[model samples]
Target: MNMKEANKKAVEIILKGQPTLVGIGKALDVIPGMKEDIFLHAGPPITWERMSGPLKGAIIGGLIYEGKATNQAEAEKIAESNGIKFAPCHHHDTVGPMAGVVTPSMPVFIMENKTFGNKSYCTLNEGLGKVLRYGAFSDEVIDRLKWMEKTLAPVLKEGLKIYGGEMNIKNLIAQALLMGDEGHNRNKGGTSLFIREIAPSLIRSSFDRESVAKVIEFIHSNDHFFLNLTMPAAKCIIQAAEGIKGCSILTTMARNGTDFGIRVSSMPDKWFVGKAQDVDGLYFPGYSLKDANPDIGDSVITETAGFGGFAMAAAPAIVQFVGGTPKDAIRMTLEMYEICEGENDTFKIPALNFKGSPTGIDLAKIIETGILPSINTGIAHKDPGIGQVGAGLVKPPRNCFEEAFEEFVNSMEKELSNE
Candidate 1:
């Protein structure tokens, strides 16, 4: 097929299955493998020394949560001895945020893209700062995980059931755009909108008065909670678009606990990768660049699909995280529009005077601009055993796309010759 045909097919696949949450008790509420007792990690597998601070903490916490070991020291021995297999959530068709691992039994969010009828899953947000998603696994973090599983997940699951159909994420994303949420790294508005849509059902669910209070409090307190939902929603949407021949749409972005990689629609299972960059952003007290590690996780796909650092202008408040001026936010989002295929009429940005948000990174345009995609990410300490220590902005190495493009061109030529 011609390049135009390939692009059209790719767009078709992307539009086919956008995802949404529809039920209670899905795995989304639980951390990775919380219920299964088998915790999984992000990207490809690596040795213990390669793990970041937050990732290490997450592993230790997973051990604690799973009753695999009594303490961090024991957990380290167990992990090194191969008592627990090291596999990527991506291998399971799932994505984890930092050292993302899901033990079975944890309530997980289940998102379905009705158009393509495909599904994707992820665990709930751990409420930031020394939490599992950021690679922290402290006692405090462990306790919070327990509370989320035992209390928050059940209540929200019941509440979510009141809306029997999928949450219309496409529409929600559109609304969030106008409200100053780029969906990733800055989901304040999107989180609020999500709570509002699910609130009616949540109220109707059988949560006790105290549970209701707790759920309400939790939702109000954590701005990133909705990020959990958005990740799966975006995952479900993009996964639906995978596997269209000649369609150069990106289907995945992941770090194998070592390297950052991406997959395209046409190259379904093949990976085009770049060295993961270190994060450069604000850090919690007692943490600095010295403690940071290369970028890790499956969440970068959110930005790749549009709305993380790319849509920063919609969420100028994000400047505090990545340390850029308000103008930089606008420029970032604007630049993304140049690489993307079209504007999402549904997701509008008031900062851009109601301009539709950018959607679908266009390979052709990306090649033309010579600007690699921008992402806001958390930083893990280079040393294994330490978890996340900071957060910052990063751009995918250009060589990745350059290599992929050359291969794609060669593949097309082969097709022409065969024809």
Candidate 2:
């Protein structure tokens, strides 16, 4: 097919996706190709030596959680010794936020794109602050992970089984946009909706009332709890567009602490990479910009699917965390439309008069318009074990998109040569 026809098919496949929160299961069981020795992280792949501090810290935490190491020093030693393997979550049809580390023993949510029959995985969210995803490898972090594996995962799994129906994630996202959540950075509405859908099954489950209450209370308390769910949900939606010949829209945008990378539909296996950029936004008291690490996370997948930052106009209240005025949020959404292939009919924005979110990021348009996708993310501290210090907006370095544009031109040239 011509590029235009391919892009049209890609956009339709992506927008037609219906991701559902199927259930939860152990990482080794639910995640495709997961193994006891492999450590899956958030962004494009990197090795131990090249990994950032937070990424390193999360590995340490993952090691302890997996019983691969007894303490931080042991974890570090094994990591440097190459006693374990490392890979990106995206490579396994999974996605993670921030430090995005997943060990064999952790619990993960299974998301299925019913329309396309593809599945994606992501670990449950550990509410913000000193969480493993942010690279905090302290005792508290390990303990919290253990609790999630032992309690939260099982509760949710049973609840989903009892509920026995697909949790229509696309509809939830649509409703969330109307309720002022952009499906990343700010997910209060989505989390609330998730709870509403599952609370009944959770209550009816055989688990003790106390455990049920704790799970419900825990989810209720953490607004970002839904971030993990949305990450894989977005991945499930976007992956439907992968491998369409001549399609130029992006299917992946992610960051390992060390690099920012993107994959386009036409070149699904190749990652165009650049230096990860630093974030600019408000910081917690006593933590200045100096404490912030460069942008990190698979959460940007939300933006790739066309909501997160691309739908900022629908979540103006998000400015409270990402440091922008309401007008800036609207403008960000407007600017995004110029670089995207189309609007997401299901993920509509109320502020834009119920217009769909800018979807299917077109690499050609980004280079042509000189616009980078805007991502609002939590800021990890520069040092290992420091966790999150702030929240803010960031842009992947321009060089990545430039590289993607080069790939696009070369692809066209190759096709013409063949013709």
Candidate 3:
């Protein structure tokens, strides 16, 4: 098929994909291809030697969590010793936010694409600051991680089971848009909606009253509770559109704090990478731009599925946190339309008068328009243990899109020649 036909086919699959939250489980048991000693990270692949501070910090945290080390120094030595294996979460049908480290025992949300019978996985969101995702691994961080695995994961698993079949994630995301959640950095609406849906089963669950209350409190307290759900949902949607030959639709956009990467539907496994850029926005009182780590996270999956940054018009209030005006949010959404192939029929933006959010990023459009996809992201601190310093907007490196477009052209030319 020609590029046009290929793109049409890709968009068709993307729009029709249905991702539902199936259950929660350990990474090794739930995520496909997850194995002992293998940790899935964010963005393109990189070794321990080349990893950035936050990435290294996360690996050190993972080592501690896995019982391989008792202290940060030992963890660092273990990582450098080649005893650990690092791979991108995308390679294992898993996605993680920020540092995006998924060790064997970490609990993950499993999403199933009911439309295509495919599954995707993402680790649970650990609130915001002092979390492993941002490369912080203090005693508090390790304790929180343990609590999530022991108490939170089991309760969610039981709650999901008691709730019966898979929960429709797309529906939650659509309703969330109306309630002012773009399904990424701002998921307060989505988190509330999720609690509303699961409260009934959680209340009646066999777990004791205190346990139920703790689980509910945890869910209610963390506004980003919906982010993990959204990531896997986006993964399922984009995975459905994978392998459409000659399609220029971008299926993946992620960062590991050091490098940013993108993958097109036609070249599903090949990553077009560029240096991860620092975010430009608001920072905490004690932190400045100098203290911030570069943009990081698999949360970009939300934009890949046509919401998040693309649906910013629906969440104008987000500007207060991310350092922008309401008009800037709307303008960003409007600008995104130029680089996308179509509007997502399912994920509508209420602020835009029920118009579908721009969906299916097309490399050709980006190259032609010279506009990069804007991302709403959390900024980790550059040093380990400092955690989140800020939240802001960032754009994928231009060279990433340019290189993807060039690769697409080469692939198309090769296909034509074979014909």
Candidate 4:
């Protein structure tokens, strides 16, 4: 098939994907290829020597959580000594936000692409502030992690079972867009929709009233609770489009706080990387642009699946948190259309007159339009343990897309020569 035919086939596969929240389980139990000493991180793979501050901090936290080290010093020693293995979550059919660290014992949300039978995994969101995902490994962070593993995971697991089976994540995301969530940095609507679906099951389960209430309260208090759910859902959607030979569709976009990376459908496992860019937007008090780390997270998976930044037009209020005018948000969504191959049929945006959000990012179009994919992301503190400093907009470096396009052209030329 020609490149254009291959691209159309890739887009068709992505559009037909149906991502569902199948269940929740421990990372070791649910994620394929997870091992006791293996720690999965965000973005493309990098070594301890080259890891950015936030990524390093997260690794230390993971070591402590896994009981491989007793303290930060010991954790650092283990990390530096090669006692632990580091791999990107993407390498293992998983994704994590920010530092995106996942240890064996951590609870992960499980999503399955009903159309393709592929499953994706992502850890539960830690509910903001001083969490390990942002490079914070304080006692509070550790305690919260423990509570999630011991308390939250079980409750949610039971709740899913009680509700009969997998929840359709794509449907929730569709309703969320109408309710004002773009399913990325702003997930208030999505969280509420999720709670609504699961609350009844929690109440009917064997758990006591107080325990159920506590679980509901925890979810209610965290607006981004749906983020973890949506992330794996997005992964399932994008992975469904994978392995389309000769297609130039972008299947992944992620950051490791130090570098931004992209993977194309045609290229499969090959990662095209560029330096991570600093976010340009509002900051919390006492923080400035200098205090912010470069954009980081596996959350960009949401955009790769075609909602997050691409649905900015659907959630105008998101600009208040991410720093942009409503017009800018709409413009970003409209501009994305120039580079994407199609619109998502299931994940529609209400504000765009019920139009579908732009989907299927095309590398050739990106190079042609000179437009990088826009991302709305959380800004971590430059120093480990300082937590989130701000939220804002960033774009993957132009060089990454350009490089992928060049590789695509080379492969296509070789194919033609063989013909």
Candidate 5:
């Protein structure tokens, strides 16, 4: 089949499936291991050695929260001694931001794309700066995680239950784009829309008024709460296109502290990998370039599938962190359209005159165009123990995609001969 035909088939398959985390886990065939008492943020089973600082910090904080360890040092030793197994959220067909850590006790969002019956999963955004995803593991971070476990998750679960059924992430994402959210790096509009959707159920849930209030406060305070929504949305889209024969669409992109791995639509289940790229962006107070970690996490699947840094025109505020002017952001979004298969009509961008955001990256086009996908990511301190120290812009090395394409061509040749 030709590229257009392959692209169309891939989109059809993706749209046919509903996105769910468990479904993604089943699809990817990996179950993230979680501390029986501690909660994780994303994906199936990970080991401590495979974890980045932020992930490690999140893990240590989780140990303390579970009373499994008394302090960071103790938690570190326990993790090193094989007490914990590191896994990628993507391994479980899930995604997470920054450290992308997930524990059993944490509340995870489950998105089902009803159309295709597939699902995607991710942890809720923990607001910004010094939060767990950024790699800060401290009493304060642990305390916040406790509050989310004890208060926020329960109430949100109750509220969502009352609403009943999967949230329509596609529609929310479309609206968010128009309202000024890139759906990654910047989530202002998406968060507001998410609040509006769950507010009524939240008000009626059996959780006490204070509990509901706290949930509201948390969502309102974290401009990126809707990030959880976008992650599943991307998962929904990417999974929809999986398993298409002869297709070269990228199915996954994730980091495991030490390396970044990718899977393509054509290759179905094989992983193509490279070293994680370093992030170069603005820093929080008391942090600098010296402290940033290389890019990590399965969250890049969102951008690769369309809508993260690729849709930056919708969230120019991202410029402050990732180093780009508003014009550059718009250009980036527009440039992505050149390499993608089509526009995601559901996710419209007002800045682009209400045009749909670019969607479905085409690996062939990327190779032909020589344009690597753009990503906005949090920077972890290089030292595994320092955790997240900043945020910025980076690109996956072109070689990974190039290698996947080469293998895809070889596979195609073999199939042709068999025919």
Candidate 6:
């Protein structure tokens, strides 16, 4: 098929996807390629020698969390020892936030694309500041992770069973968008809705009252608690677009602290990478750009699927967190529309008279228009243990799309010559 026809087919599959949160399971059990010695991080793969500090730190924490090491020094040693293998979460049909490490023992949300019969997984959000996803592995971080494993996961798992097998995430996110969630950096609306939907089932579960109360409190306190859910849901939607021959639409846009990468729908295995860019936005009182790491996380999957940054106009309040005015938010959304194939059917932005969100990043459009996708994200400290320094806006390096577009043209020309 030609590029236009291929892109239309791919975008339709993405829009038609209905990702449901089926349940939660240990990383070793539910994630497709998970294994005891395997560690999954965000973005395209990188080795210990090339890994950024935050990515390396998360790997150390994962080793310690999995009992393969006793202390930081030991964990660091084991991580680079080759006995522990590192892979990207995307390789196994999963997604995660900053640093995005998934160890064997960690509990992860399981999302199934009810429309496509595919699945995606993500670890629970650890809240903000000095958490594992940001590469912090202090005593409190490890302790909190233990609590999530022991109490939180089970409660949510049982709650899902009580919720009659699954919860439709598309409907939930659609409602959340109307309620002021852009389904990315700002998810207060989605978290509140999530709690409302699952609380009844959680309360009705056999777990005792105090445990349920703590779980409720934990989720209530963290506005971004719903982020993990959205990441995998987006992944479930976008993964459906893969394997479509001649499609020039982008199936993935991700960053490991060291590299920004993109995958074309027709060439999913070929990663076009560029150096990760520094974020430009608001920081905590004492932190500045010098303290921030290059952009990182699987969270950009939200933008790739057409909601996060693409729907910024819907959440004008996001500026309070990511640093920009309401007009800036709307401007970003308008700019994104130029690079995408079309607007989303499920996620509508009320600020524009309930217009559908711009969805499906089209590589051809990026090449033709020279406009890039912008993402709002949490800022992590350059060093491993400092955690989140702030929140901000970022865009993937232009070289990534430039390289991918170059290949797309070359591939198409080769096909034409042969024909």
Superposed model 6: Cα runs more than 4 Å off: none
- Please identify model 1 stretches exceeding 4 Å from their true place: 24-38, 44-49, 380-389
User: 1-419 in candidate 3: lDDT tens per residue?
Assistant: 67898888888888998999999989988788889989899988888877888888899999998899999999988888888889999999988999999999999999999999999999888898889999999989999899999988888888888899579999999899998889998999999989999989888778899988988998898999899998899999999998888899999999988899999998999998999998998998899999988888888999988999899999987987998888998999999999888888988877788999999998899999989898999999988767888899998888988888887898789888998
lDDT of 3 at 84: 85
Q: What is the lDDT of residue 392 in candidate 5?
A: 79
Candidate 1 is scored at a TM of 0.90
- Cα lDDT for residue 391, candidate 4: 93
Minimum summed lDDT over a 10-residue window in model 6 is located at: 74-83
- Per-residue lDDT of 55-174 in model 4, one digit per residue for the tens? 888888888877788788999999999998999999999999999999999999999999999999999888887889999888888888988898888989999999987899989998
lDDT of each: 0.71, 0.91, 0.90, 0.90, 0.72, 0.91
| RMSD from true fold, candidate 2 | 0.8
Please give the distance, in angstroms, between residue 248's alpha carbon in candidate 4 and its true position after superposition: 0.6
- Tens digit per residue, CA lDDT, model 5, 1-419: 86468877876665444443231121112234444533444322445666666677777776676677889899888888867565566656567877777766566777766777666677767777667776677777778877877777777777777776446677777677777678777788878987898899889999888889888988999887888778877887788788887777777777754567778887767877777777768887898876776777667777867788888888877777677789988888898888877776566677888786777778888889998888887677755335556667888877788998888888888987887
**Model 2 residue 374 distance off true place after TM-score fit, in angstroms:** 1.0
The number of residue pairs in model 4 that clash at the backbone is 0
RMSD per model, one decimal: 2.9, 0.8, 0.9, 1.0, 3.4, 0.9
Residue lDDT tens for model 2, 1-419: 68888888989999899999887888898798998899999899899998988999899988888898899899899999999999999999999999899888889988999998999999999998889999998888888888998999898989999998568888888899999999998899999999999999999999999999999999999999988888888999999999888889999999998999999998899998999999988899999888888999999999999899899999988887889989999999999999988988899999999999999999988888898899999999988898999999998999988988897889789887899
Question: Over the full model, what C-alpha lDDT does candidate 4 score relative to the true structure?
Answer: 0.90
Residue 150, candidate 5: C-alpha displacement in angstroms: 1.6
